[model samples]
Target: MSELTCFKAYDIRGKLGTELDTSIAYRIGCAYAQVINPTKVVVGEDVRATSNEIKNAFAQGLMDMGVDVLDIGLCGTEEIYFATKFLGISGGAMITASHNPIDYNGLKLVREDSKPVSNDTGLLDIKLSAEKNDFTFADVKGTMSVVDTTKEYIEHLIGYVAIDTLKPMRIVVNGGNGAAAPTLDRLEVAFKQKNIPIEFIKMNHEPDSTFPNGIPNPLLHEQQAVTGDQVKAHKADLGIAWDGDFDRCFLWDSDGRFIEGYYIVGLLAEAFLLKNPGASIIHDPRLLWNTIDIVEQNGGKAIQSQTGHAYIKEIMRKEDAVYGGEMSAHHYFKDFAYCDSGMIPWLLVVDLLSRRSTDLQTLVSKRMTAYPSPGEINRKVADADVAIVAVRAKFEADSIAIDTTDGVSLSFEQWRFNLRKSNTEPVVRLNLETRGDAVLMQAKTDEILAILDAHA
Candidate 1:
């Protein structure tokens, strides 16, 4: 048995064969069974090549511990959450590297009610158990059964938004050859049955583990271009794309420009507030001015949170927030067990556009101009902590205020910047936004980059 090194701060992930394999995955399954100790555990995998092997090994390990396994085959990360909650099963694990490279595979585990399990959560217990490699087998092992959640997931998603009186709209979907194609294709079928006014244009809808086009991460400019071109080519109202497991999604305007996730946070906050007025909403601290402005101006309470899914979800459940959003394209809902979904946000966005006779550009265009943000930029460095400390020291001389909810976030009257260490890699991620001043945003970005570069 090899020592485990892929147990990350957030989830278990590593390069295939070297850092992870069927054997290690099997041990993790057993460890999960031990930690969660649920009577039944729901399992799911993405469209990756090694997902099956890992899923099978995990299932075997679960059953060996006499824990019943309900396998929902070939679904996105949120689908597993739905299965676990919809079926009242124990915790579940989704086999995906989530926007990681094709050569990598990992797991996202959650407790019952779709609560995330991070390193500080039950993952530590799982790590210890996997290292020990001791799983006591019962006299009779639990059985494994396959369940299809496609239809149920679709119904649940559509139920969140109005589909009956949806207006006629042309929508372009670019799955980026990840898991979103199958779900979107099925959703298209459902939209057709409802007589909803929607024109569907699907591109790169096939699920290819190799990701021949590129990694499905919409954060990259090149990746966004492919989907943007489709939106312009089809002359569609909006375009949407998903990451590898389809957990978090990205959007493009009718004019083929990538809508920053910060504005989408405001858009969805406004959407939910219309229904449940005065409901609390959680906003990540990284990008906050516009989200706070829109949420408060619209009679919704905005609660600032740290930068990760674990922190966001925990805050949501505690505050009973109606909605939560991260500028990284993660949207969490109170209805969906306070878990993040790449699927629900688009559905709600579609509903918003349909209900109001407005195109995607019109809905978010004003916010973009009002809060022009320098999109997130990352810099590789030998010691990310050193770079962060150096940046903080420079800013401390005349800094207005500083907060380290997730990383180092400095706030000033005109501009603000969040310089944080990446949880998964040896790089520091930077996000800077100004109150409608594009020039100031660029200047702050350049200053931060210089600091990071000097440290590098």
Candidate 2:
């Protein structure tokens, strides 16, 4: 009866046993196949027990619609993007929950060149078609075949970063027990064969669906400790970790300090601008001060985009942007078909350091101090609207410009803050930054917290 059960603001995510059974997945695939009318579709899955089954069911649906399926079994989300472009497929889908718990699963759909499919695009139509239960199977059913896209993917990734040029550096990598190990293993061997003096301190490299070491989400403080400790203990050049599906990645400096994604955006922007001057860079509106300053200073254009992969990719496509990054650890590249890659950022940074005579901390230290931000703070309240209104109203009376494009962003001469309500959760996310002043940023952050408390 409920036709709007599968669609979400960004992707198709639902519980496993109840809303997201194999039948629903297959029907959704059939609907997608009919809508897109693509000849070839690339499919990939994460490290979950149900992932393969769901993927196969969806493949069946596609095949029923006379669409050939190119199944890249057990690969990361980025690999799906690579396969789509490398094989010139019509589109691709990745069955992954990302950082979600094992009980949940979802599908991230994309068009050719890995164009994201959101509600504004064709996701809503696909959902409606699936719910109607009137799929028109093709007279000639499509066929399916599996292919390993990792070799070409790794080769292309290596081209992005010169592993052979890497210096004798000790690095720490925590796979978090997800899908990162395979790629890392191949990369490690490549680095070794090239005699790029480097050492790998691997933790939780084994992929286990049960997540014995815990769910492979590096965003949580609990999971970040293992990589941070390894960085400190080994005095490694840096630490890298990935989420459940290895789509988004997190990093730590040599000193066991977790570098926020905001600074990394600046770092990568700076690095990319060095080679491609006068290029355009895309960034989410959540954190703008640092990215804007860095991009502009490096002779690159900084474009603000709405949150989510779909919006970012769409904007990048139109603008032909060279790079786009989000503070949430999503990095998109032009060569990668405007798709986010969890493997590219660290490699770029590492290559930059290897070619130069500087350490990771030294490279980012000045920028970190110049534009310090109160790393995204989340507060759970009963009503996110009430909290956002209270915060916005309190700040708007001070002769500041306010915009609600995606959220309430108040800009003052000295400082600015954005308070947005999360669509995926019942919470208000706040990010504030000052003009080279940590004390002022902290003061504004505390003031907003007081308003939140009073309203709560």
Best by lDDT: 1
**lDDT tens readout by residue for model 1, 18-64:** 99999999999889988888788899889899999999998899999
TM-score of 2: 0.97
Cα deviation of 305, candidate 2, in Å: 0.9
TM-score on alpha carbons, each prediction: 0.97, 0.97
Runs of candidate 2 with Cα error greater than 4 angstroms are: none
Worst 10 residues of 1 by lDDT: 160-169
Q: Stretches of candidate 1 above 4 Å error?
A: none
How many steric clashes between backbone atoms does each model show? 0, 0
lDDT of each: 0.88, 0.87
Q: After the best TM-score superposition of candidate 1, give how far the Cα of residue 416 lies from its true spot, in angstroms.
A: 1.2
In TM-score terms, candidate 1 sits at 0.97
**Residue pairs whose backbone atoms clash in candidate 1:** none
